[model samples]
Target: MTTTAPPEHPPAGSAPGSAAGRLWRAGRAPAAVIGLLVAVSVLLSLGSEQFPSGHLEPGSPEPDGARALVRLLDEDSDLTVARTSEAAVRAVERSGEDTVLVVLLDHRLLPEELDTLAGLGSDTVLVRPSLRSLAAFAPGADMTGRVDDERTLEPGCALPAAASAGDAGVTGELYTAGNGVEALGCYPAADGSGLLQVAAPDGSTTTVLGTGDPLTNRELDSAGNAALALNLLSAEDVVWLRPDVPEEVGSATLWELVPAGVRWSLAPLALTLLLFALWRGRRMGALVPESLPALVRASETTEGRAGLYQSRKARDRAASALRNGFLERSVPKLGLRTDSGPDSVVAAAAARSGEDPQDLWRLLYPSQPDPYTADDEAMLRLADELDRLSGRLR
Candidate 1:
């Protein structure tokens, strides 16, 4: 008669060599690619400066850059116009009293740097300056809010530049000067200030225009943008302080940079990951217990019993089982009858196992038969004794 053999399976560690295995392997590339894409997107969104520079760069031809305005200043007037961001006093001084420093960088400059620029001999014009920038360069000049005016705002103030510029797109951060501060606030929003001008004690002027639309290439032709931009920037000399992106002044951790909502959400994510790991690692089926025949090899039986005992932490039961099995084999080997008393079995086992007779007697015939107390070390010693006794007979 012909018989069929059982199907083979992959070993514990070996990857399966089948159609399913091939599919799994094939899926890995796409999975890795997707994960990498997600990681890159997250990094870009989190760190603002992670992307390339040139937001308002003068040299850049991008829509946001001041290249057109720089070119206009270079070509339109016969005055010296330098398209540079470096804080060089010598360049400004060389242009003499007619030098005008038009700072296009909005929020990049540090407080000290703005202060230094304000103190220069040249007339300064800061376009869309930050609060910190306002504090440093234009003292008493604080941004009020957004412009509420729907139409183009006129230069209502006495400043000649604003007056000549007429109605321009002054529809952004509104400014207000504090009391006793000798400054002219033109292009009046709902409140006092829009285009602020502070005359320094040394006669050098510091002008803070609320919007950059007047100078940008796209908006330069709009309303009186050209007129305003030229009036503000076209002195005998113009120093465009387009500062480089500044380094983070203070060191901060990744956790500190993360938003509060994102940080708070991580706890639930960690818990979900833990649950997923547990679910993935859990055993699929229940264990099936097996009983071996009495005629099984002594070592194999002993190893099987040891595994069971260890799983259940039944040290005492394991020790007793080991001793009983040894006695059953040894009594017959030493010529003692199967139904022999405990003393005789112990004496015979001790002689063969090379252990003390009294010690064997106590271990074999303990106070309790079913339940007894034995630690791991005692169980090990008992198993070793049985092995030695069985070996001697062989």
Candidate 2:
């Protein structure tokens, strides 16, 4: 007879020469894609100024008109112009000398602060450049003189002829003033004290110096308001109260502003991804068998076999496994017919061994019983008798 050859097994890890194997072997494309993404990110960050952490510097000093007035006061007056805040107001008030509180009121003051100024008595000279500021220091305190009735005026218009004559030798008659387009109207207090509202020298108050450009260094020299600047610095000891502009409280730094929660979440996700990558990169070792053994042992043989039986609904096959030993012992003792039906086999076994027919039936057929109601002792006794009888007969 001619010998037949065994079918060849596929080589371990070698491509099977199939469509799936060919697709899996094509790995260069994905590597190229990953390399392209990294290259793009690097190029963009290098070329673009708008990239994160791009070069940026704080803004250069802006031209502030108020700085001119501040410099003038610092130079001309016996006044020591020191920047102060709202917090220092009480301290300044407590000092209680004839204090010239030169407050740079950008907008109108609150009624309460204005009242506080009024309550300070005649010892205090409140020089406000704007009607709003005047309103703050002296609410309804004769704004008729502080603001001119006329709406317009000519340029280079001198102060009222009367004001020039009156303040000729007066010490603190013109306490503070501003030089700009929108000048607040100046007025004399009932006691002849000067409340020099920052207005144009002309009769018209409409050109009030709302823009403090004349006070700033850049425009102060250009605006030709040096005389007005000198008047504002007339006080012997002037206190410049520059309240800080209101800014958002508790603003975060660049690092603090970035959401840490998202970063932390991404970190964990990246760590998990790295672990998956390591798992994927690891080799599983050589796949081919070195030699054949008497029997091959599977790691989960019992569990896999049970699962297969369960999935196939093979109850009879499962019961056959349990009864295999019993059937071997009983065959000789009872001369049990191997090809007989379960009922006939069990009846013959009971008659030959003089055991309970029901017990023998349970051992052979094993009708599904309540898990809690199993007759374990009876089954054991039946097995023992069958074993003893099988030995004697043999």
Candidate 3:
């Protein structure tokens, strides 16, 4: 009987005109768009006041309590107003000559910051609303005011020197800026030259001014407190320091400082793109035509062969095919399985082939069929016999 081969099916990825191919062709546009969007957003944000930059206007007034003090100093004093924060204080101290260190403390001062201010040696002023009475009266004593008095000052008011009477260790004069709205505390140095601590009657200390708002532009115009603010900060070149809150500092540059995990992810992405580029541009071979034969169906051919085998009861033939298949598969594994068969066949073959009988027996009928348990001796003998038999057959 004459038989013809069926048509060849193309490999899954062989069609260069497939959807995957289209995607491969069109992928660059979206990537370019995304890159452009990111670039634009960064540029626009950099142009806005929200994005912090060194070249922009100094002492941009934020809508907070500090703005009052900021405006007051900017409008009234010869001092150049430069906004700063606690973190940048050292830089300001270093660069600023005759700089006024305004601590808008609306609460008690941290020990370290207090120590830092105490050591400044230059003139420093602590301004707020609640602590004015303290600076006006008590110069070095602790606050003797009640907690209710402390609470009476608005959310950003300085603490009173009287309230901190027992706790006052810093040596500075505390002065009041406004009635309950604002205050200032001045702490003088040992020679009575450098301003140290200022307290408000509302029971807030000079440290509180660093936190409260009488110094900000928003409230400096309200209740005639601007004069008081200018008077307090006017002695030196005004540096308007705005310390960034911890959360703001943390979220500030989020995208620029990519972490290690992101960097590793980008590496794999870059490699994948490189591989894709290599695959797309390199021409493999020419496409070949495939034609189907009209004679036979695959299913019919398989069923007919099975029926013929069954009708003939070709057990020996089937076994021979299985043995041949096994031999073909196993022989290449170190030229092994050449001596595989029943013992008599193995012995007859070994003798006829000049191979060891004992070794042939081990290959033909392994005592332990398990690969894990097969002994080294059996493996070695079988390998030697198989090699000899394979050489003879070849």
Candidate 4:
């Protein structure tokens, strides 16, 4: 079919406001929008200081830090606060009963460290003990669950520490004191206990407090928190053990690092992405009729037919058509009848072309032993010989 030629493209730099320039201009809006969004985020982060920093760190001045409590122990009280676990252990070792080893950040401590701290001759206070640390240090005390409320509660049990503190912020993990150990359960939870004081065989006390919130700088002044912290930390020397993240725990598996909620949340996001891909990747527009060349030459059609015949291996059909076409065209030129037999046609062709009659007969028709089988090679040979004889007739 007839087709119009496409319009020629303009030379490079011909038009300053071409499609390329327009495309470049189009990207600026999105880039500026992204930059603005980033700037806004940075400004918001700089403006707000809602969350506390350096959780439970003695040296930190942030609200969440235990700097106030450390200062209280260092200045107001006579107890000298030893910072690291190594220093605390050494101080406890040197002073013996004179030193009080107060364990903070118990979750970071190793089992061996917990054992060492638990077996100390001096009184030890464990703040925010993980289940593993609690089980290792205080055998009978088991964490039940977490407390929803962070409000102060009355000291229900008769432990001297609790009784003296009166109402205290013991709102964290609730625990239960088993019958095997000589332990006092304090700050009674609905189901179990919030605090446990176990008398170790080494003549030293192991106090398990549920949370470290009450001991932090922010909550230290709230509801008998100062009184409770002071009473618990009252000693000649204080060894504050801030346990570092253990090597074994630090090498936790990928699954352990991802929280359950975050893992669950990924499922929906993944499904959404999958659905988006399917939607965007699908075939979009409807089918349109394509224009073809207006005219196909006779020679091209003949070559195309031959190609189709060769591809389909239609040797018999091709041979028959070739022979019929040759005979129909050459019969008039050779002065032979249209109804002439194969022998007559071969004799006429041989006489005109000066070829042997036997060869012409063989080319015209298959012999008794080997009838026309329509093999591709045999068909081609016959067609070529026929063309040579037909040339003689012309």
Candidate 5:
């Protein structure tokens, strides 16, 4: 195959409008398109403001975040946002009777931490508690129902906070008090209610608000949501615990995990690799290309590959190379499509060479174990046949 020769080396120039300048001219349009896209992206990004978003988070200004309620509570209460169960417990302990511990995402805490928090006996609010959290915070208070719709439910119970809040967007998980459990259920929906107030034996109250929707930034202003959140959380000190990604349970050193022998070898291995890189790498600038002869010599490449095949005694591979070259050149000349079926190729090849179709098929698309692969002479014979056939077609 022949190819138009490219320059053996890039012309040496440092000027702004030399060989490099032409390259720049060729590429500037695409670069300008990319630049415009980047500019538009930057402008769009600048025009839009993204608020930190998280579910019922105090600092997040997203629809699900409690930032609006948090700000309201911050006005009246000394609010502390804690990301860990340990920190939440500590925050509550530091405060007096005027403090209320409000725990969100209690599912992130361990069973022991939940029990310890429950044991604090502080006026607490559990938001969307898991069954385990429910059992720890308010025993015998089971999640009995769920409010699928986003309707505003009336405060049906006599809880001061619920009543003051009036009708609220408490459309979320619902719960029920056990038969003997002395608890007050509020905002009745379906079989259960959205809020369960259970007074601890130690004079502390555990208020389980079934849904977090009412406290989130998006719904805080709708129908007494702000009032209810403020009423429950307004205290001298309020500890708002919103758990983050759970901390690693246990610690293990990655280096220590490796075998002692392997670990000891790593230092020397790294040093040797660095030294080897420095020794073998290019010490200065880029490689200079060798100048090409004015005349092209394509046959040199073909002869070099032929010599390699002969040295390795790769008869099967040599036969394959011969057949592939003939097919590539003759198939197109024979008006056969590159993707034509094997039968069409075989028939066309047979017609062009004036040979029997079966013999042509055996030569071009050999059957089981390939008869030509037996020896060098057979491979030579196959190559001769393909070359003769291709010559005839030409």
Candidate 6:
């Protein structure tokens, strides 16, 4: 009678220890690494300063800050203090058509952003813009004069905005408009108008103010400044964009320009590569000690190696090999330990062979540029000396 037991199945392909288990084991280290990285990034972000600081910053309360005017504007209109061009554009879009976009410190914005903002077609106020910014918002208009004296300039134009504001301390850069264009100038100066309003093709009006002083906390209450500032900024929705100076703008960093996700993928990719390397390493089994298929004679092996050394013109190496081989064989025969120091071995060999210690030392332990290493003939001479020395030792 015969009874057979069922074969034992391996744990790899059965039940809960299959695919899910392997995946978990393989991915756990990488997952932990990703988790730590995310935690560190969050902590660093939390510790950083988010608000930008500069002139005309809506939140700042310094003398140059427009926080007071911003608060006043907020009381009458839904005000959005935007730090970037995209944010400003988005806020304006959300607020609908009745929004008034105020752009100050325009030099901080890129040239392209300025062009985009100019196309927004909203009733806008430009406060002390750069030459390029002026061109984008107000074509054919140029800064012509600068008023050095900080004095009140009467609203010389018949425009409603200036007429309502009355006389104001708007003493700063002036501008002039092109001929026949629908334009109005106020705050009279010697060379150009302090305030210039020009008509846009989209039926929106772009009013350029010569100075930012009227909107600052310091001069907000002086003269007709408050009235002028309010008149220019009046709307149901107000978008104030005072962009931050782009970091190291003249020589911006490469990291700042890289697309966001590319920088984040490096860690996971490295872990994946490492896991692949480990898996490959695991598949390699223990090394087997393989015996020579056919035993090689010592003399034949020596001659083959010597032939290679001669072909390569390795005279120094050949000389060294010949001396080391002779010492290894002869030292043990002279009752000296294999690890005996060179000088001790040399002295013992010199005594046994009755040879001069200096001459034996030169022949056995050669330095660089030894006579034997110069040519094949010299190397042969060294081999003859070693053979002679070996015969004496016996």
Top candidate when judged by lDDT against the true structure: 6
lDDT minimum window of 10 residues, candidate 5: 260-269
Q: What C-alpha RMSD separates each model from the true structure? A: 16.9, 18.9, 18.9, 15.4, 16.6, 10.6
Q: Write the per-residue lDDT of candidate 3 for residues 332-351, one digit (tens) a residue.
A: 44333556446446655565
Candidate 2, superposed: residue stretches over 4 Å from native: 1-61, 78-99, 106-109, 121-133, 136-209, 245-308, 311-394
- Whose TM-score is higher: candidate 1's or candidate 4's? 4
TM-score winner: 5
How do the residues 1-394 of candidate 2 rate in per-residue lDDT, one tens digit apiece? 9998999877655657776667766755655655665555445445543312101101112454354455556675444433334443664555445445555553434556555544543223333344555554433333233222222122223454223323221212223333343433333333322333433233212112323333455444543344554554455555555544455878767777755443344544455457658856888998786766566568678788978976876655655654676676666566666666777766776676677878666555656762212344544455565567555444
> Candidate 3: global Cα-lDDT?
0.45
Total clashing pairs in model 1? 0
Q: How big is the positional error of residue 329 in model 5, measured in Å on the Cα after superposition? A: 24
| Quality of model 5 by C-alpha lDDT | 0.83
Predicted candidate 5 versus true structure: per-residue lDDT over 1-394, tens digit per residue: 9999986774566566688788888768656655665555445545655565689878888788888788878888888989888998889889888889998888788899899998988999999899999899899999988888988999997888889889998888888989888899889987798888987788888888888888888888899988888888878999998888765755657876655544444554455557556755746887789887686578988898889998998877888887787778878987989888889998887787788999888988888788997888888788787777777877
**Once model 2 is optimally superposed onto the true structure by TM-score, how far is the C-alpha of residue 286 displaced, in angstroms?**
18
TM-score of each: 0.47, 0.34, 0.35, 0.48, 0.54, 0.51
Model 1 agreement with the true structure over 68-110: per-residue lDDT tens digits: 7778787854344343334445467666677787776646665
Query: Count of backbone clashes for each model?
Result: 0, 16, 82, 3, 0, 0
Q: lDDT (CA) for every model shown? A: 0.71, 0.46, 0.45, 0.75, 0.83, 0.86
TM-score of 1: 0.47
Better of 4 and 5 by lDDT: 5
Predicted candidate 6 versus true structure: per-residue lDDT over 1-394, tens digit per residue? 9999999876765557679788888888767866776666555545554443468889878888898999999999999989899999999879878889999989888899999998888988999889999899999888998997889999988988789989998889999988767788998889988899989878998899989999998999999999999988889999999887676545857886654454554555566568757765684678899998998899999899989998999887888889889988999988999999889988999889999999987898867679888887888899999999999999
Worst 10 residues of 2 by lDDT: 51-60
Better of 2 and 4 by TM-score: 4
